[model samples]
Target chain A: MSAGLSIAREEWRLWARSRVVLLAGVIVAVLLVVTSALTALRVADEAEARAARQASAEATFLAQPDRHPHRMVHYGHYAFRTPPPLAAFDPGVDAVTGQSIFLEGHRQNTAMFADARAGADLGGFAGLTPANIYQLLLPLLLIIIGHGVLLRERESGTLAVLLAQGQSALTLAGGKALALAGVVGAFLLPVTALAAYGAARGEPALTAALMVAGYGLYLAVWAALILAVSLWVRQRSVALGVLIFVWLLTALVVPRLGINAGSAAIDAPGKIESDLVMLAEQRKLGDGHNAADPAFAALQKQVLEQYGAEKVEELPMNWRGVVAGYSEKKLTDLMNQYAEKRMAQEAEQSRIVTLFGFASPTLAVGAASRTLAGTDLATHHRFLREAEALRFDFVQGLNDLHATKLTFADDAKRSADPEAEKRTRVNAAAWRLLDDFRFVPDPAAARAARAALPLAMLLGWLVLLGGAIVAGARRLRP
Target chain B: MIPALEARSLSLVRDGTTVLEDVSFTVAPGEIYALLGGNGAGKSTTLLTFLGFLAPSCGSVLVNGRAVAEDVDGARSAIAYLPEAASLYGHLDAYENLGYFLDLAARKVSRAAMDEALDQVALPREARGRRMQSYSKGMRQKTAIALALLRDTPILLLDEPTSGLDPVAIDEFHDMLKGLADAGRSVLMVTHDVYGACQVADRVGLLRGGRLVGSFEAAAGERIDTETVHAAFAAREAA
Candidate 1:
């Protein structure tokens, strides 16, 4: 242990003396801090934009002229999903999912316009949060530094002298790993502070801690792999090439393949197909336009009988309000069922992709980061579900007020007379009863549990790294 | 007493090519043995196998009576090797490079001891503080010598130790080798410079076809001239 520590210290001494290593490490750390600040700013901006939109929507809804409840049902409400606080750390799939969704009685629209990948190189480069830096950028830098550790000794013919002087293979490997670990730690500092910040703010501290652990293990894996290759390959060039190839495979190729496989396995309906299908289902269930439609007419008859009225004019209640409420119920059910089916498809796709997590921990980590930040597909789905439920409640509440309060003859004549329609409008009393949109973050424990799979893969990588150390040690004899 | 370094029928085969075959020799304490050979004559190969950098196909290499490949560190600690070009980390100064190698060697000597060792190699005080990349060939060679001395191992291996040096530097290098041997250390070096070998070696061996074909003692009695040594080397190359 002492020997390993000493060797590690020596590595630091050498690393410090090497301007390139020092520069690279400093550049990485600076980039992390700058990116963290930028990500926080971006998330804050997004929150503000969404908040303003939500306020404007509420104001617009309140400013509407008095009208029959059924006419108001078609006006709909717009809700924008505000990102959770921890999202500033990871911002996961938030960009890919839409931000605002338009919801109305008898119709559902998908959340639109939130994808992060919509822009050019600037957008791609803009997503360099601390976690992204650790996952993709840090390993490659480590590869450049660590791949030549022992190979340089051999090249210079000093390795033999070092061995002659009683440096054990285990000590050598351990020391080199220790030295590289320091570099890795330096790179992780910004993210670690960010994690601590999240914890202080009462976000998922445990999840943040797990992220740090995962990243450390990931970097350690690279260090070990580099050393192993350095020992296995005789020349400096060969060792470097092998390490670069491994980095490419793990960081870029595997994740892309995993995503492609995911899409192939569980194909979700395109937005257009989902919209068309929902429209078709809506027509099938009930349409207020077709009075001859059995489902619609039956609903009308049932309401009339309940009110003890043989004809629509004789009823004190508004018939149009009753019919509108019934149609809204049928359409809401259909949309919910379709949305659930689509979510299930997406879930299946995600499950298939996560199967590749063991091969590439970055994908697993990326997903976990997004999930913890409440910006993943699941979070988006939750927001959509909550917003749709709220829309149903608000529209239904208005319909109920219209049915029992307004006279059927008055509501029918309101359609022809502007002043009568104004009289038929439900007052602000109904609007005040409906709730505002609220976004809930995923629980801390749940985030940790969700991150478990990636953590396991990181552990697996640790084992593999340990194996490489042993194997490399064995090969070091000659 | 056991030889400081020995190869008993040591051989090496790589990718179906015989790089070294049945090479046997020894350098006892207070002795200098120069190995002379043509290009690809397996001189460097023999040294690497002894250092446990290359695994021998047959027989064994013993440093201080222990097989090198069997106990890599034990064998390595018993010897210091100087490659032909003596490449050091270009980014590090002489002192820094030496410090790093000493650490790798697991030596606990202080900075003063390292400087003392550099002084023994006759390296100029100014050169020791300069980056090795900016060093001249002779200066780099001097640093390699200083490193071997700092290691203070029983045996020293050199591949063409005098390949690139001025006459003054070459003479100084020979004097250092002699001094090391006089201090009861064994020196096994590969060189074609018959005159330089004669200056430092107690004996010399000729390598041909991956085999040590001839061995010559360099004592005052029966001492050979540069002409005879050159002819013998030429004959071996032709053969």
Candidate 2:
């Protein structure tokens, strides 16, 4: 056998005989399996619940009784976001981002019932999810196993004997790295199986592949880093201390700091502030509620001139409906402008956090995993945009119904005369004619493209860590 | 004929401090050379320089006529080393440890060969299969010696090989060294045990302050006395 393999075999033998290492391995394996299974079940359950809620909301909308088209607009629709199948492997931002949005006329509501808000106590802990285990705990396990790989030899004086026996330091280091990499592979098996199951169950194959590739690179980075530290540090205890500190700094501390830094770097307006601004803009532009408001007097005159009519009575259509449509369009434009600004700000915060990935491979892999799973801030924004578009179409369609189907004479007399009020009610069949709001997720290629940067950052870390290992090996001596 | 090991005016500096200075020595084939020194006397530093673990600031260490710095692996392949307290993987059995290190040295041995080396080193056949962690210091030494025998190198480098062994175990270890010397292998030992050196070494060198100051040889059919070796160390202290 080659010297590296021989060394690795001895390490395997040693690990087998060590009850502590064996017990640690078993505990980590059990944690991985249980967390992965629970995450898959939770994701699947949420998806089913969201689909059911969406169906129920659609049914309720179409079942409305006869009412004025404007009343129907007030009874707005609900849009529920469905998680992609691969979310089982990595729920990503789904734990924090809200899952359902309320859509109505002249208003866009924020998504509500986010887990972070609902499960406040547990949200800070991330609920023992699979991604959390891989991100936080698995690397710790690697550090425990590998911190002594070289230090033991040095402490025991086997290093001198081995060196004098013609064993190159590179071969010894390579052997230890190979051994730890084997452990990494074993740790990754259950998660890889979960990802494959997701792919087989109709999740995008390319996304599953990318997720697995990303995690492989991530774990490899840890293994290389652990080995490098082991070889470079002089004492076993010191090596362990250094590795633990590294794990804490990179995995636990830096991500939180990066998020805070990112938030500090880019400011996003809160919901109330944005709502107040939109309200102010709405007032400044024109109130769609009153047809005779001075804000639309100019619009009314322009309409009269375009139709060559001197007054509303001479117009071909109910001028009230035309005025309502114009006001709805103006309000929709103002709402979209503010919403886009807020999304841009949130995106900037996320970008700042992504830049820190260059320093911490853990964060890089976490970002890539979320992006590929379609559970990131970008995906959340996409859902909101799609929901807004659907809302505009649904509300505007009702406005068109008001313009063409309901007569202005009846609408104007409805409050005073019961018969006129009854005549102004459109048929409930119109609700059924409106299309359901369906959110189509971005294609696998698009998500892969979006995630490509973080993934490359992770790969870059792996390459740099490989260089460290090589340099450490070159410097190994007794 | 090429000497098994030679150091000509070797000097080594570590961390900007000179640890070994102008040391010269040679161990011909089938001869045993023991170096005696107090703590910080640069005995271990000399061995490390010979193993190419530390490069000399001046001169060179040659194994079988090849400079250690110029061809470290080639020089190392000709040596089997035993540290002051030879340590093996605590979890592995003596035989397994022997096989592993032998394989590390690019020598694959059969089970019977491993058993023979263990037996030759006087380690009990039953104890060879048990974990080395439970073995006593003497047994660990025997295991290290068995590894050296299995390596079958031309030269053996031992750093205080008998320091921790009991008197009886030390005597047996001296006999083992004598047997290796008789078998045409050169041995260089670094130790504080003057009597142990007199018993096993053909020539003894006294080191003081990183320099070899005095030497005594055991002529044919003659053994160097303990007092003669003591006087050499005393003379250096007086000077």
Candidate 3:
């Protein structure tokens, strides 16, 4: 056997003999299995529940009683986003971003019932998913197992003897790194199995493989880091302390700090502020309610010119419905503009967070994992956008029915005249004509493209860390 | 004949302080040289330089006629080292540790060969499979010696190899050193045991203030006593 392999084999034998190491390994494996099973179960339950709720909402919308088209518009509809399949592996940003959104004409609602808000007693800490365990805890286990790999040799005067036996320092460092990396691989096996199972259950095979790659690179970074520290530091105690501190700074502290930094760097307008702004813009632009508010005078003239009619009474269709459609167009356009601005701001904040990946590779891997899992903010925004589009289509369809089926005279007189109100009611069959809200996920190619930057950043971290390990190996001395 | 190990007026300065100065020595094939010194007399420093752990500020260290600085690995391949209190992996058995070290030295030996090497060093067959952590000082040293025998290097460097061994174990260790020298291997041992040096070394050199001040040869039909070795260190202290 090669010297490096021999060293690694001996290290494995020693680890097998050590009861504490074996116990710790078993505990980590058990925790990973239990947590992964629980997370998968929870995610599956949520997905099924969301699908059922969505079906019920659609049924309720289509089962509305015969009523005036405007009244039905006021009733609105709800859109519940089902969790993506990979969320079982890494439910990134899912807990914080609510699942269901209320869509209506002239208004866009924020997604409500976020998991984080519902489980506020845990304060965003309730979801101890397997991904979190692997990213945060497994590295600590590696540190504990490997911190003494080199320092013990130094302290016991074995390093000098080993070197004198013609073992190059680089080979020794490589051997220890290989041993620790093997531990890392063992720790990752359960996670890989979970991902493979996820893929087998009809999840995107490429996405599952990407998740494994992202996390595998993450653990490899830790292995290299632990080995580097173990070889560079002179004392076991100091190495332990340094590695623990690194874990704290990278895994725990940097993510939180990055969020704060991102928020501070790019200010996303609050929901209330956005809503108030959109409301003011609507009022200034003219509420779609009034037919002769002078705002639609130009629109009225345009409709008349197109039909070649000199007066409203001469028009074939109800002028009220035409005015409503025109006004609705203006309102929807303004709302879309505001939504785009808000999305831009959110994107900027996310960009700032991504930039911090240079400071901590953990953050980079987290970003890449979320992007591949399709639970990121961008996916949430996509859901909202699709819901908004469906709302426009259904509301506009109702307005079209009112213009053709109900007479202009009856619609105007319905508030005062009971018989006219009865005449203005459209049949319940019209509701069935409206299309259902369906969210088409972003294409896999698009997700892969979006995740490339963070993935590259992670790879960059690995390269730099690899360089440091090599440099450290060169400096090794008894 | 080429010397198995040679130091040519070697001088080493650590942290701007001279630890070894103008010291020179050689051990021929089938010879044992013992260096006696007080604390901080550069005995260990010379061994470190010869092991290529440190580069001399002036002069050179050659193992098997190759400069250690220019060809560290090549020079190292020709030597074996047993450090003071020689420690192996506490978690690994003696045979396993020896096998690991042998692999490190780029030599692959069979289990029977390993057992034979252990036998040569008087390590009990049963103790070969026991973890080094449970071994006494003598047993650990014997394991280290077994590794050296497995390496089969022409030159051996030992730094206080018998410092903590019991009298009987030390006697056995001395016999092992004699056996190694008779087998055409060269050994250089650094110690403070004057009587032990007189019993086993082919020649004994006394070092004081980083300099080799006195030398006695057992091979030259010279009867060197413990008092003569003590006087060499005492005179340096008096000066």
Candidate 4:
């Protein structure tokens, strides 16, 4: 213990003298502070804007004067997903996935207003969030700082001196790791403060804690690996070169290339393709307005049988509204089937990309961090599904009003006869009965559950690197 | 008393080739022994074996009468080793280097004692606080020697200890070795300088092609002859 601690102390003393490393550390600390504060402000402003827009959309729909209920269904509403509180820290897929959906009848709209669509580098490093600093930059900084820890000693012949001082190779390795851990902790300070701020601002405490834990483990993995490689290699330049390559592979190359490959392999249908296919299928269901259309012959007869009437005038309520309601159910079913298949493919792609985490702790911590932040793929999908549900519910409510509120004789010739058209309009107060679109984000337990495997993968990396350090210590050159 | 350091028929093979072949030597308490050899003649390899950095391919190397292979850390604990040129951390001052190394040895010394050791090595007190990166080769060597002195171990192993020192510094270093020997500490230093080896050693061994080909010893209160040992070394290399 004395040997290890002394080694660690000496290392710290040496680092204090290294101007370049110290300067780099100071710069990174300041960068994290400035970027995280800016991100918090952006998130707050975005949430407010989305809420305002959602309210405006609802007001616009309800403000309409008396009109055919069918017209209200076409007028539609909007659902805006308020940013998750922890988005100030991670932001995850939010920048690429969009936050608002246009919820109209018959058509299930994709989310609009994604930053990626606005040419924001797909939320790449150009986006500059705190999560990027933790996932990408910290490990690279550690690599640059500690790559030569052991090699410098051996090259300068100090390793022999230390070894001859009765320091076991294992102890020397342990001491270096302890010292590196100190540096990693120092780097984590700003992020730790960010976590505290988030918790104070009402983000889930467990998620913040886990984010902190995941990042710590992620850096520890890099530290152990740096020591192990330094112990194994013979030269400082070689260790630096090898570690940089490793950093590049883990932090950048694998994640981008692997996700792209996974997405390619799954071949999920695009929004345009799915929409075109649905339009074709909807055509088979025919136009819902014309009760004389052959597509509704069976439905028209069914209504007539129920009423024991031979024709439209004999029915008490308008038959067109019943047909409109029935046709909508079929179209929504088609929309659901396509939506579920697309979501399944998207989920599969995300799963495959997550499997790449096994190769890179950076990816593992990234996935876990985003999940805890409630900005992951599942959350985005949840928003879409919920918006669709509200779209279906409100559209059908309008259809029910259309059927029971107006007479068949007035609705059929309303276009040609002004009096009939005036009689056909329903009360303007009917829009009040519609359900509002409120986004329910996944619970903390669900986020924690989804993050479980990625966090475990990070743990697995730490353990694996730890095992390498132990095994490599024995092989350390004196 | 058990020999302070011993190598009983030590031989080492690395990468399918032998570097040391059946070499045997010992230093009694208070004795100064030097192994003289040219490059790749295995002088450093023998010192490494005593420190247990390299396991013996055959035979045994021991320190304080314990088999080094069986108790390597114990062997290392009993000895202080100074490598060729003694490259201390260029970013650390002499005092910091000594303190760090002494800390690694799990021993603590007072600042006054550290000053005393540095004074004995003739290192400038002003330079003791400056980073070694600005130090001359001789100053760095002096700092390493001060570190070895501070270790206070019963046995010392030095590989090319006087490589960068001037004639005056070399003389001072040889005199220090004699004083250490007189105080009953054993030393085993490996070097190629015939005069330097003859100047300090109570006994000397000549190594050629990884074999100990010749040996010399001084009478009581005397030193080995440089000319005779140098002649023998040249003859063996020529053969």
Best by TM-score: 2
* Residue runs of model 4 more than 4 Å from their true location after superposition: A116-126
- The weakest ten consecutive residues by lDDT in model 4 chain A span A117-126
Q: Interface RMSD of the predictions, in order shown?
A: 3.3, 1.0, 1.2, 1.3
lDDT of 4 by residue, A79-107 (tens): 88877667888888898888898777778
Candidate 2 per-residue C-alpha lDDT over A1-478 given as tens digits, one digit per residue, 9 for 90 to 100: 7878888888887887888889988988787777677666666666676777767877888898888898888788788777777777777777777778877887888886465532443453336778878888889988888789888999999888887887888999999988887777787787778778878877788988888888888888898888888888899899889989988898988898899998888878876699896786689777776788899989999989999999876777777777788998998888889989999998998988988898888899899989988889999999989888888888888888888888878888889999999988888998975666666667999999999999999888888888888898898887
lDDT of each: 0.77, 0.85, 0.83, 0.86
Task: Categorize the docking of model 2.
Answer: high
DockQ metric for all predictions: 0.42, 0.85, 0.81, 0.81
Clashing pairs in 2: none
State the lDDT at B207 in candidate 4.
Answer: 90
**Candidate 4 structure lDDT:** 0.86
* Order of quality (lDDT): 4, 2, 3, 1
Candidate with top lDDT is 4
TM-score of candidate 3 versus the correct structure, residues matched by position: 0.95
Model 1 ranges off by over 4 Å: A22-34, A63-67, A113-134, A288-293, A300-320, A407-409, A416-423, B54-56, B67-72, B221-224
Model 3, A402-448: lDDT tens digits are 77888888888889999999999988988786565556556778888
Candidate 4: tens digits of C-alpha lDDT, residues B1-239: 89999989989999999999999999999999999989889999999999888999999998999999999888988898889967699888888888888877767888999999999878998999999999987788778878878888888898998998889878888888888889888999999999999999999999988889899999887888888999998888788
lDDT for each residue of candidate 1 in A263-327, tens digit (9 for 90 to 100): 88778986669978677667677676443467777776886788887877776666666776777
Q: Give stretches of model 3 more than 4 Å off.
A: A117-125, B219-223, B237-239
